[model samples]
Target: MGVFDGVVSALRSAGCVFAEEEARLLLAEASSPGDLARNVQRRVAGVPLEHILGWAEFAGRRILVEPGVFVPRRRTELLVHEALALLPDAPQPAPPVVVDLCCGSGAVGAAIIQQAPWVELHAADIEPSAVLCARRNVGPMGGQVHAGDLFDALPPALRGQVRVLVVNAPYVPTEAIRTMPPEARLYEPVASLDGGPDGLDFHRRVAAGSLGWLAPGGHLLIETSQRQAGGTSAILAAAGFLTRTVHSEEVDGTVVVGCLAAGMTQG
Candidate 1:
């Protein structure tokens, strides 16, 4: 049998759902047969497909995903949709300023930039690994990446100037970590997945800081579980935002959108 056939057999036997497709991708990525075997072994060992391939396809774009970084999910494309829909209708000379706080690989920011060519994009993450991964994807999109806890990483100049703040922060409950897939539990950082008791720690942090970063009429869209959407939305509302929830049944994604209330904490 050929190298690809062997690899496909091994991956299929190991529980890969798309054996042939993965084999094809591995073949395209490997420079030699020896490397292909090693790569296939990693896959068989349960490494995430994106980690094995060193990249992930998100929002129709290839994003660089490194080990120890959260892999952007296709479902996150819903965040891009909500952010885009929040754009103001008026024509402006300069592109809207947008920030992707807690950006893992900056897929949301990169996708937003791709969707709106003129948008000024910025992304930040607390984890050093995630910050590096974000740079690989966001930098190419003419976006700047910063490393620090959520809004704190942004420059003073951007305060109250963000037009659309898209976030996909860690929202998985702490106790539920034991239930997560091994790939995430073993590979990703605890801070990237453990969202305190109720899974709204990061959500609250993001919502509270957004009021300081968002411009008048700006929007913040944060991804959360449908079960937690109400609590997440309450955080935004308590932070003086006019809030609403947008859900996508097809993808099982829920987003809590927050708009800064009129005359709320404005400079």
Candidate 2:
């Protein structure tokens, strides 16, 4: 069989739903016959294709993704869309401040900057690998990537200055993680997937901490499953934010947006 057909057969046998497309991508990414063989072997062994290729296509950009980093999902684009919608139009006195909390590969923050280059971008993650991977993707775009736990990773100067805070925190219920695809459970960090017992741990934390960092009238957007959207909204509401949930059926994306009232101070 030809190279393409052989790859397609191998991927198909490995239960890759889009075997042909993956084959094409692998072929294009391969530097030589040996490289192609090694890539195919890895894919068949259940390694994520993006890890092998060293990047993931997210929000119309090629985001660098290191091994063990959480791959950016298409659904997370909803966070970027909602954030851009909240940004003020051009000719402002200064660039608006934006933060991507729990940033994995910094894909969400990078995409936001791509759409609104005028915004000052900062992204942070607790995982060292993710922080490093994020730096590569957002650094060139003038975005700062920091390392630390949620909220702590940010610079103290950013307090009360962030105009749009976007988050893609882990929302998978702890017990449900084992049921996730091997590509995720086996490869990605558990810290990037486990959302505590009920899948709202990080949501509660983000909402509770957001008021102090968000500017008056600033918005916080969090990506969550449709089933968890109401819970996420409620967490924000209890934290003194006026909350709204946005759902995109096309990408199966759901984001909960919380706006701090213009007159409210961090209490």
Candidate 3:
């Protein structure tokens, strides 16, 4: 059999759901026959294909994804789309500023910038690996990457000036980590996957801190599971935001968006 056929067989035997597609990508990325073998081995060992390829496609853009960094899921594109829809039209003295919290590989931020090149993009992640990876992906877009807990990593000047806040924070329940696919549970950092008790920990924290950073009439868009959308919406409402939920049946993605009313005082 040809190398491609053999590679597909190995990947399929090792539980890859889309072995043919993965094999094609691996072959395209491999430098030689030996490299193809090594890539195939890594796939068989359960490493994420994106990790092996060193990038992921999000919103039609290729985002750099490094080892141990959270792989951007296709579903999270819904968060970007919802955020893009809420961005105010251009006419002001400055472009809208956007913050991507828990910005794993900066995929969401990178995608936003790709679509809205005028945005002033900033992305933050607590993990060093994610920070480094984000710098690579976001820097080229004229965006800045910060390493610290949510909100703290942003510049002081950003307070009350950010027009958009997008997030794809960890939302997997603590216990559910053990049940996630091995590629996530074993390859990605726990801090990037565990959402504490009911998976609303990050949502609550993001909501509480959002008012201090969002501009009047700014919007906050967060990715969440369909099952947890209500909880996320409630947190946003309690934070004084006008809350709404958007879902993409095509990608099975759900995003909860909260908007701070124009001229409204912070609560």
Candidate 4:
């Protein structure tokens, strides 16, 4: 068989749904016959294709992704879209401050900058590998990447200055993780997938801490499953944000957006 056919057969046998397309991508990215073989072997072994290719496509951009780093999902683009919508249309005296909390590969933050280059961006993650991978994707765009848990990773000066805070925090219920595809459960860090017992742990933490860091009238957007959208909105509402949930059927993306009252800025 020719190279393309052979690759497709191998991927198909391994249960890859889009084997032909994946074969094309692998063939295109591979440097040589040996490299292609190795790439195919990894995919068949259930390593995420993004890890093998070293990047993921998000918001129409190629985002750098490292092995063991959480891959950016198309569903999280909803957070990016909602955030850009909340930014002031006219130029501000100072650029809008945007934060990507729980940033994985910094894909969401990087996409935000691609569309709105004027915003001051900062991204943070608790995972060391994710923090390093994020730097390569976000640093070149003039965004800062920090390492620490949740809000702690950010600079204190960012408090009450951030206009848009976007998050893709883990929302998978702890027990449901094992049921997830092997590509994720086996390869991605547990910290990137575990969302505590009910899948709202990070959401609660983010909402509770957001008020102090958000500017007056600032917006917070969180990516969540459709089933968990109401719970996420409620968490934000209880934390003093006016909340709404938005979903895109095309992408199967759902986002809960919360806006602080215009005069509610805090230190």
RMSD of 4: 1.0
lDDT (10s digit) by residue, model 3, range 1-267 = 998899999999999999999999999999998999999999999999999999998889899998999999999989888888877555356989999999999999988888888889999999999999999999998999998999989899998988899989899999999999999999999999999999999999999888888888888898999999999999998878898899999989999988876555463
* Best first by lDDT, ranked: 4, 2, 3, 1
**Backbone clash count for every predicted candidate, in the order shown:** 0, 0, 0, 0
Stronger candidate by TM-score (1 vs 3): 3
**Lowest summed-lDDT stretch of 10 residues in model 2?**
258-267
Off by over 4 Å in 1: 88-91
Worst lDDT run of 10 residues, candidate 3, spans: 258-267
Task: Give every collision pair in model 1.
Answer: none
Give the TM-scores of the predictions, in the order they appear: 0.94, 0.98, 0.97, 0.98
What overall lDDT goes with each candidate model?
0.87, 0.92, 0.91, 0.93
Better of 1 and 3 by lDDT: 3
* Superposition error at 220 for model 2 (Å): 0.6
User: Compared with the true structure, what per-residue lDDT tens digits does model 4 show for residues 56-129?
Assistant: 99999999998889999998888888898988666678999999999999999999887888889999999999
lDDT, candidate 4, equals: 0.93
Report the alpha-carbon TM-score of model 4 versus the true structure. Answer: 0.98
RMSD of 1: 1.8
Q: How many backbone clashes does candidate 2 have?
A: 0
All models, RMSD in angstroms: 1.8, 1.0, 1.4, 1.0
